[model samples]
Target: MAYERLYILVEGDDDKRFFEKILTPLFEGKYDQVKVWKYAQQKKEKVSQFLKSIKGMNADYIYVSDIDQEPCVTARKQYIQSKFKEIDKDRIIVVIREIESWYLAVLDDKSSKRLGIRYSNTTDNVTKEQFNDLIPRK
Candidate 1:
């Protein structure tokens, strides 16, 4: 089914920014509207409640979060499914280890140099703290 609108629920401001930068270009001309919601402060229960409330909306929904220390992406995704069974299985994306890994994947040598951070291929082991350290404070 082709969706005219896409609603993305992300874990934090960084996740929102990452989606804005990445998905916008990747999904350009595909969706008539794209909205990203930063729900970092909400607990898992609250997030599930919000998802339940948004059911039947005329839009495609996507939830993105870091896998953290989960056994694997499948486990993380299954955990989310256990809480929000209404959500489409394909729309839930759990980044391996952390969302910073995604950021790292896109960062080139030039960008890393400009940001004054060394480029490290540490996606599998990147932690929230390490991710935060790499991001330049505004």
Candidate 2:
């Protein structure tokens, strides 16, 4: 089913920015709106209310988080499930190393020029450290 609006729930501001700049382009022309919602600092009540509201709109949510300190993606998902109990298991995405890896993954030649970052074609096992290290110094 195609949702009119899609919400991507992520861990922090950088995740939000990455989704907005990188992932949103992939979703463009498909979803009417692709919202990258950073849920880290939101109050529990606000987060709960926002999730509840999705049911009333033509929207679906995907939960994305880094596999930080976890043994594996399954373990990380299990941990997140404890908090986001109401969400379906399939909606959760625990990045292999971290969301930063995705930022690197998207930095192909054209994207790098557009985003002003260096290109990277080999981010299969990369992490946040690489992402941070590649950040433009100005």
lDDT of 2 by residue, 68-106 (tens): 888988888898778756666788887777777766675
Clashing pairs in 2: none
Cα distance off (Å), candidate 2, residue 93: 1.3
Measured with C-alpha atoms, the lDDT of residue 32 in candidate 2 is 80
lDDT of 1 by residue, 29-63 (tens): 78878888887787877777777765756567789
Could you estimate the TM-score for every candidate?
A: 0.78, 0.73
Worst 10-residue lDDT window, candidate 1: 50-59
Q: Model 2, residue 34: what's the lDDT?
A: 80
Give the whole-model CA lDDT for all candidates, comma-separated.
Answer: 0.78, 0.78
Off by over 4 Å in 2: 1-3, 106-130, 133-138
Top of the candidates by TM-score: 1
